[model samples]
Target chain A: MVRIRNLRKSYGSYQALRGLTMEIPRGELFGFVGPNGAGKTTTMKIIAGLMRADSGEVVVADRMLSGKTGQIREMVGYVPDFFGVYDDLKVQEYLEFFASLYGMDGKEARRRTAELLEMLGMTQLRDEMVDGMSRGMKQKLCVARALVNTPELLILDEPASGMEPRYRRQLKELLQELCAEGMTILISSHNLNELAEMCTSIGVISKGRMVMQGDVPTLLRRQRETNPYVLQCLSFPEEAIQILKSDPHVKNIASSGTNISFPYDGTEEEAAELLTALVAKGAQIVSFYREEGSLEKMFLDMTTVP
Target chain B: MRHLNPVYKIGLKQSARTKKTVVLLLVYNLLLSGLGLVVFYLTFDRAGRVREDVAYSGILTLYSVMAAMEFVMILFIVPASTAGAVAGEREKQTLDILLSTKITPFHIVTGKLAASISMVILLVISSMPVLSVVFCIGGVTVSALFVFLLLLVVTAVYIGSFGIFFSVCCRKTTGATVCAYLAMIIVVILLPGLLFFFECLEAFGSVGYIGIRNVMNTISGKRTLFLLFNPVISFVSMLRDQVGRGISIMNSIGSEGGLFYFLSRHWFAASMVSQLVVSAIMIALSAHRLNPTRKGWKSGRSG
Candidate 1:
């Protein structure tokens, strides 16, 4: 649904986005992961038509992002990392206001406002002043406001930032439900575990460059080839480690109590063969399992590239 | 086009709730009528005599009051209203969310400007009782009052334009507020003071009065040209001409046959055309400022 090519932006001497290129497929929940100052916000802003890119092409919904900014704005719902609400405006009024901006009339705006507030669990706060609501409630309200126009693509920058755990779970559920409804979402969050659980696809950015982007399982699988997996033994852990280290496919080994971990580059057959050889050597098998690969681990491995 | 655009409804609600706005309107109406009542009572006994001096001095004083009132109101209101328009949005961090919507920049600019001017007009209308008191004395016709109201609207439009412009340009509320105030000071007090000083020099035979008169004329003409750019000045000018029978000092000096007499004869017609042109320009300029995504004037479209 979204494609960016050679997207570059600079703030004087500081380059925020450096020829970053990536594409997000339609109806997929894309997770954007990056450390501080990684051009995540810059990229999102360009897509939202809120800021200009120095040079690049962004195509969304078959229209050039920059040239057809108005159309693009109509197609996308954006929730910024930090946001504020009109103090005296009620929750319903706030939602209705944004709905109207998208050309929704009074009756239509009221209908959409009611639907979004209910969906986001903000119906109780409909008549409450915006300032009187809690931080989590306000964030949910912002999300509802963004959804007022029923945008096909939602670009949310840290939508779960200040929410309590329960509300955060509610936001996750709402996002999952939206994704299930075939709405594309590009979400950025520091909470990698949540992102890993929620996102079907993920992109890792570092220093304005897309270090990696693809399906979550594929990325995890690729990174796992180089990841160290631990093998635990009830006894003779050192003997098990020594046996694995001697194998050519096993590059290195580290031990913790009765657990021994090593970087394995062999196929599943070879790994199974090595385990059989260890059993033949009389090493007691307490636990035999490969380490679970997650987006958080892959993110740490890629972005921590010093 | 959305009948219930959040920005529009919220803007109107906020205006209604603002204590400062409510108090300003009340005080403005009470003061105008109170002072106007006293003027009427004093001149009630000499209603016929007031018309005799409908000459240069009478027009000049009226112009002064008109200018002063609008300038002062702008000085007070623009800072309070527009200083917070964009800057507050940024501080709230809601600008990004608002910009993300289909509402064009022009729409946002205009919506804010309309909200502010609505409050200003409310304040101006509240003083109508005082204006009605002027009718107790003769020579101030209803047509004249209509012209005066037109002038006020024009001047308000002009002043309100600058407020929006500055609000858009400045990143911080304090910066916008200070810049707006400074600009007003230059337009209302400083520019006139400089012109009058030069005129005084001409009076002392150091330079020709015509030279000083030309400077004032240029200023007045420029002011008229940018009338919509600053409505406070136009409103004051119109008020002086309609209620007080005074010509702007600059116009008086610049035009031949004593500029005041010239304006006194064609007050309504001249102001109507001049202000309309100025208001159009101001509105267009404001629209331009609001559309930041557009590199410059070209074949660009607004959402």
Candidate 2:
């Protein structure tokens, strides 16, 4: 639903986005991960039609974002990392206001506002002033505001920032539900695990470049080839370490107390065989399991400059 | 009719709903009533008797004061209303969200400006009943009142445009407001002062009673060419002309030869048109400043 090609943006001498390129298909929940100043927000802003790139192309929902802002804006819902709402407006009025901004008539805007409020669980506070609501409630309102236009693509920059775990989970579930309903979402956040649990695909950026990006499982699998294995021993941990060191598949080993972990580049059958050999060599193996590759580990591995 | 611009609609709703607006309107009316009472009291003779001509003159003075006060209030209030319109959005961090929508920068600028102008118009309309006190005594006509209202709106547009332009140019509301007020001061006070000094030099250079007449004529004449740019001067001249004054100082200067004469003849119209033109340019510039794709305009990344 969104495609960016060689997008480059500079702030004087510092390049914020340097030749960055990525594509997200329709109905995909894409997680954009990057460290501080890694240009995730910049890319999202460019796609939202709130910013201009020095050079490159951004196509959202089949429309070019450069000069076709009105068309692209109609197709995209944007939630900035930091946003503010009209304090004096009630929750319902706020939503209705934004809906009207998208040219929805009063009747349609009211209907959509009611639906969004109910969907976002804000119906109870429909008449409440926005200024008095908590930050989490306000964040939910912003998300609802973005969806007021029923945009096909949602570009959220750190939507879960500064939220309690419960609200974060609610947002995660909401996004997943939206994706299930055929809305494409490109979200950026520091919470890798949340993204891992919800995103259909992930992109890792560093130093203004897309270091790695793909389907979550594919990224994890790619990391798993050089994945480490941790062997927790009831006894004979030293012997287990020695055995692991001598093994052809073991590239490196580190031991602390009863646990020994090492990087293993071997097939599952070979892994089982190696475990059997360690057990046969008088190494008490209470638990022997390959470390499960996670999005956080993959992100760090891909983005950390060696 | 087309649907109202959403920004303008929301802005008006929010402004109307605010308690501050209600309080301001009440206080404004009270102040006008107080001024009217004072004018009423001063119109009577020392023995507490009211003379017909004096009462008529008092009503005329009251109308002049009301119009001038309304203009001054609009000048003061419009900048405050609009100087923070865009800058407040930026400060609240809501500008990006607004920019992300289908609305163009022109829509945003015009909507904001229209909202401010609407408030000024509201103030002017609400004061009409107080101004109608003049009609009771027979000094002001409906057409004259209509012209005064039009002049007030045009002046509000002129001042409010400056406020919005500065709001778009400045990152903070406080800075924009200061700049707007400063610009108003220059246009309303400093510029006229400088022009008067130059006119004085011309008046003093010539000799005899003609020189003195030239001085009086200069004050009544070519000086208006410069004063035409000042809304205060234009407003005062309009009021003076409406009150049975034949051939205003501006018109007298227009009776002389040269380009100043042409400018003098059309001084009021030229001033109104020129203010509108300048306001239009400022509004366009503000819209341009808000546009992200415009060349040399800073994008969200840099911001």
Candidate 3:
């Protein structure tokens, strides 16, 4: 639904985006992950037609981003990391106001407002003033506002920030449902586990570049190869450590109490052979399992700047 | 129409629903009534023997005082109101959301300008009863009253445009307000003052009077064009015409009678067109600043 090629932006001496490139297919929930200053928001802003890239090409919802932002804005729903609501404006009025901006007539705006309020479970708060609502409620209202245009591609920057777990879960489920219904969503959040659970595909950006991206399970399974295998010894932990030191595939082996962990770069047959030798050596192994990889771990491993 | 700008509605709704708007209306009308009463109270005879011409003069004076007060209120309040329009949206963090919509920048600029002017108009409409007090004695005409209202509205547009320009140029409302007022002080007060000083030097004390009309009549070269930008001079010129037959100050100075008479007779019309053009330029500049492709606002990074 969105494609960026070699996008670059600089603020004076500091470069924010450095030849970044990525793409999201139609009807996929793409998770955008990066550390601080990794240009995730900048990229999203460029795609949503909120900011101009210094040099690059971006096609969002099949339209090339150019001098005309109006068309792109119509096709894209953008929920920034930090946003505000008009005080003294009722929740329903606020939603309808945004809908009207998208060229919806009064009848269309009312229908859409009612539909969004129902979708957000904010029907009871329709008459309540926007500023009087809680922050989480306001955040949900912002999401509803973004969805008012029924955009083809939705870009949310840190949508789950400061959200309660229950509401966050609801937002996740809502996004998943939207994706299932053929809407393309590009979301950036610090909640890696939530993204992993909810996203159909994941793209990890580091230093303004797409370092890694693929389907969630496939990416994780590929990442799982680098994960360390940890062994727990009921006894003879020193013997297990000595065996690990002798093996070239087992590097940086760490032992604590009865547990020993190290990354293994061997095939399944070689791994089985090593385990058999360790078992026959009277290491008294109690448990040995490869640590599963997570989105959080993968994000840290990819974007942690020294 | 359904195509009315929603931001305008949002601005009007917020302004109307706030206690500040209510308090402003009450205090403004009270000040008008109280001051109108005071001008009459101090001017009228102590005993119950007021003359007709004196009463007529008092009503005219009352009309003049109230009109000047409203003009002054527009000069000050319009700037205060509009200087925060765009900057407030930026501070509230809603500007990005608004700009990211399908609404054009022209809509944002014009919608905000309309809302600001609407607040001033609301004040003027609400105070009509107090102004209507002039009709009790019979001196001021309804057409004159409307001219005053039009002048006030034009002046609001004149001042509000600068306020919005500054609002878009500055990051904070405080900065925008300060800059707007500074710009107004220069245009309304200093521009005329400097031009008059130069006119005084050129006249070399030959003129009998040292007033604006005299200086305007005596002003020479392209310097007279600068006074067209002064809103205060425009209103004062318009006021001088309505009240005093405007004196023969325009035709009395040398053979260059044509330009002076035209300006002296139609200062209001000339200045209205001139100021509106300037205001349009300011609005266009502001819209440019809010342009999405412009490298204006600081872009925040996600990393």
TM-score of the second chain in each model?
Answer: 0.68, 0.89, 0.89
TM-score of the candidate numbered 1? 0.87
Q: What does the lDDT come to for candidate 1?
A: 0.72
Judged by TM-score relative to the true structure, which candidate is superior, 1 or 3?
3
- Of the true contacts between chains A and B, what fraction does model 3 have? 0.78
Residue B177 shift from truth in candidate 1, angstroms: 1.5
lDDT of 2 at B78: 87
In candidate 1, stretches whose alpha carbon ends up further than 4 angstroms from where it belongs are: A237-242, B1-6, B37-71, B199-244, B247-283, B295-303
Q: Kindly list the per-residue Cα lDDT of model 2 for residues A242-264, writing each as its tens digit.
A: 77778898986887988878888
iRMSD, model 2, in Å: 2.1
Model 1 Cα lDDT, one tens digit per residue, B1-303: 445445656677887987887788777766665655444434433443765433433333333353355446655775567667766776677776787889887778777777777777777677666555444434557776666666666556655666667777777788888877786666656765665565566555544454545544433333233332334444545555555533455254345445444543454455556655654665677656555355532211110
Indicate the TM-score of model 2.
0.93
For every model in order, what is the number of clashing pairs? 14, 0, 3
- Candidate 2: regions farther than 4 A off: A237-243, B45-55, B206-213, B216-226, B245-249, B256-266, B299-303
Better of 1 and 2 by lDDT: 2
Lowest lDDT block of 10, candidate 3 chain A: A235-244
lDDT of 1 by residue, A103-214 (tens): 8888888999989877987788899988898899888888888888888999999989979999999989999999999999999999998998889999999989999999
- Cα shift from native, residue A66, model 1 (Å): 2.5
Tell me the tens digit of each residue's lDDT in model 3 across A120-171: 8899999998879988898999999999999888889998888898889889
